[model samples]
Target chain A: MERTPITVSALNAYLKAKFDADRQLGDILLKAEVSNFKRNSSGHLYFSLKDENSQVSAVMFAGPAASLKFRPKDGDRVLVEGSVAIYVPYGQYQVYVRKMTDVGTGDLWLEYERLKQKLEAEGLFRPERKRPLPGFPKAVGVVTSPTGAAVRDVINIIGRRWPLARIIVYPTSVQGTEAKDSIVRAIAKANADARVDVLIVGRGGGSIEDLWPFNEEAVAYAIRDSKLPVVSAVGHETDFTIADFVADLRAPTPSGAAELVVPDRRALLDQLDVLARKLDYVLAKTLSAARDRLSSVASSYVFRTPERLLEKASVRLAHLDERLDLVRPDRLLADRKANLGHAETRLSSRFMAILAAAGYAYGRCAGRLELVNPLSIMTRGYAVIRKDGRIVRSVDELVQDDHLDVRLSDGSADCRVLAVRKGE
Target chain B: MAQEQELKFEEALKRLETLVRELEQGDLPLETAVAKYNEGLALAKRCHDLLKQAEEVVVKIADGETLQDFPKQRE
Candidate 1:
């Protein structure tokens, strides 16, 4: 058959139409390694999808490319969904990618690991940097989707565990294009409120694509910089995100985060019960011990019968009194009187003896005087004559016809001397 | 006393523990022990009452712009 000549544009247009009409080509899924990946200034992505032995040109426009969870790099293994079509103007066939995903090791996972390593190196994920959850949180802030089961699960669980804590839900988009910004904003808002003691950033279990927002750098940094302690519960237990690494604490599930944030009221009450019993026991023991001590002291000899302490003194005082009676003034005076009377009697007898001796001496002297007495001569009719009160022994002492006083043994007379005479 | 009244449940519990410990140590004078016992009893009662009288859980929703109380789910 003779071929009709066709222009290059027409030929290309025919090939483009053929590619578009084929159902399989319209929606092709291919797993290939990315090569020469370049994001243009217009936000369009240009790359080549290659296998070991084959390669195909691929381009993702700005619309779908804007929604990519990670920046596609050269040599990244990717699973792309797009339609194969010929560009008539370029005269080439290429895949116009609608959606792209990492195949074996997911692109989001790789991004998560890269961020985890980076933040870990920066000590964001250091155990020392991890803040301890408040033992008694006054309020719990949750950053999660408002419509999902995550918030409900968290609320219910927290209610069951510790109802004292007020739940402040910061509603956020958990998935899709705005999920990252929503999550970051929610975390910021929760931190700014300053009312919540701890923050729970979480969502229900989802695929890596659905959970990509939590792996975002912005969300990770938000968690790291949050003033409130953050608890990350992004997905299933096996799913780890960068936010989990950067957060102060990580729980496997949203319910787990709730459980971790607050303590069970019943358990605390039980602990309190134990403590109350201990308090009672301690107080009772102290009281009884104090009472026993008091009683023991009260029953001691010094306190029980205080008068016994004075009993010895009283006996001593009585003995002292009896001894004092022996030195009484009346008894002393009576003894002194007896002694004086005896002395007086002795003195009187001595005086009487002395008087008798004196009387005898006087009588002896009288007798002797009688033996040679002139007064006795007077008694025998001889009288003593005295002129001028002296005996007239000398006649010269008298004068005749002179007046004289005369003293005799019995009488005295006054006379005048008449003449003087010598006596022999 | 105002501070005691403002004591958090955890703080109250901690104080009660310390009081019990002091009582158990057993050297305080009778008057001081009695006073401590009273304080401990008060703290215990406070903790108990706080736990027992806790209000139910409350949920609030951020309605894309402002936070409001989440509607209670119908049983």
Candidate 2:
């Protein structure tokens, strides 16, 4: 040992050599929770690996950090494979991480992937399995921790969007050992209540272990069994759970679930206002159209000039009058009257001539008959006489008691025959 | 009324939209149009009343079989 004053640099270099010489220090493995994790712009990762009793500063260069499977976040449990080295400049021993992995996570990741594949094969996450959300939810059932910020966000958002729905908070332990059963029970209760039309099952952001209940098989089955449609809002936006897959709707956050559960009252009112205005507009158009029809009828020629109704009849009558003028019924009647007068005169003259001829002929016949009639000469001083039934032509044949009949033109007389003469 | 309560908000909105469309079509007779307009006015009133009367939301916490009122907590 040189008993001279050695600079701090030389002391640090000596310690660096010692640490490099040890084979155990060259390659080592450690399990600790990541804290104060940071990635600068240059891509180097700086973090502290802490445990229950102690903490160690660690650094992974840009090369290893770029090849990392996951982005190292704060509070993450990681398995680090690196070499211990004393940085001479700082005179401190730190881990120069080469390969790092999440601790106690590989098994859980394999299980998640395996279950995801199995459930996907069973069509649980199929698009058809998703139910359509109601346009308006009468009651919204929230299945989460009652005291958590998630439930508060949901309540506040729902109150803003739609306060009409009765929000039934089915208080459930969203995390920890009994979270799986509590969530299932809450879902079942909400369904049994039959008051809620939709359900939002979720919690605020948390670590993977805190969000594990949503990935459980029991929670998935509960969502599937629920009659009311379930909206899964689990953890942060990046977190995906089995409940998200099995739910009818998957919202990125609890606030998003509240938004999806009900319609905006203001928007609904706007729509209603539009419809009311449309109703009035249409009714007005209908009324106007009716008025137009009435006015059209009123302004029609038939209505404007009522006398036109008889114009056709009057024209028809005029045409009939013209036809009657062509026919000349009065002229025809006058001609018939003249014909009647001529016929009457001719008929009377013919009848009178016939009567005159008969009278003349009868007179001639009567004169001839008078010349042959012996009693007709009585009027010319001629007489027709018979004595008793014989003429006294001879005195010898006469009897003094013979009766005689004398005939005259006007009358006949009976005389007793005192004497009878033959042919006297 | 219980029956009126059964009318869903969405269904009521849909019926109102339909009434508006029918009234707008202008093909209905005067009598039917007037009746439909009256019905539309009634529906509008119902919807308006629902909006104006902002009843406090019923926030209840489920505990086993029974439900109890949840305190109104503000963020």
- The top-ranked prediction according to DockQ is 2
> How do the residues A1-424 of candidate 1 rate in per-residue lDDT, one tens digit apiece?
9998989888888888888999999999999999998989999999999999999999999999978765677877888999999988888899999999877456556766687788888888789889888888888999998878898899889898887778888988899989999899988888877557899999998767788888888888888889899999988897778888888989999999999999999998898888888878887888888789889999999798999989999999999998887688997788789889989998999899999999999999989989778767766767666655566666766668766655456765666665565654
List residue ranges in candidate 1 displaced over 4 A. Answer: A1-105, A302-306, A319-424, B1-7
Q: Write candidate 2's Cα lDDT for A1-424 as tens digits.
A: 7698999999999999999999999999998999999888998999999999999899999998877755578888899999999999999899999998877565767777888898888788989888898776778999999999999899888888787877899999988889999999889889888778899999999877789899898888889889999999999897888899999999999999999988888887898898888888888888889999999999999889989978999999999998887579897788788999989999999999999999999999988997888666787776556665654444565477756576778887886657656666
Candidate 2 chain A, run of 10 with poorest lDDT: A389-398
List of clashing residue pairs for candidate 2: A388-A403, A388-A404, A392-A421, A392-A422, A393-A421, A393-A422
DockQ of each: 0.41, 0.53
* Cα shift from native, residue A360, model 1 (Å): 13
Off by over 4 Å in 2: A1-33, A38-71, A79-100, A317-424, B1-8
Give candidate 2's TM-score: 0.66
* TM-score (0 to 1) of chain B for each candidate: 0.77, 0.74
Error of 1 at A44 (Å): 44
- Which candidate leads the pack in lDDT? 2
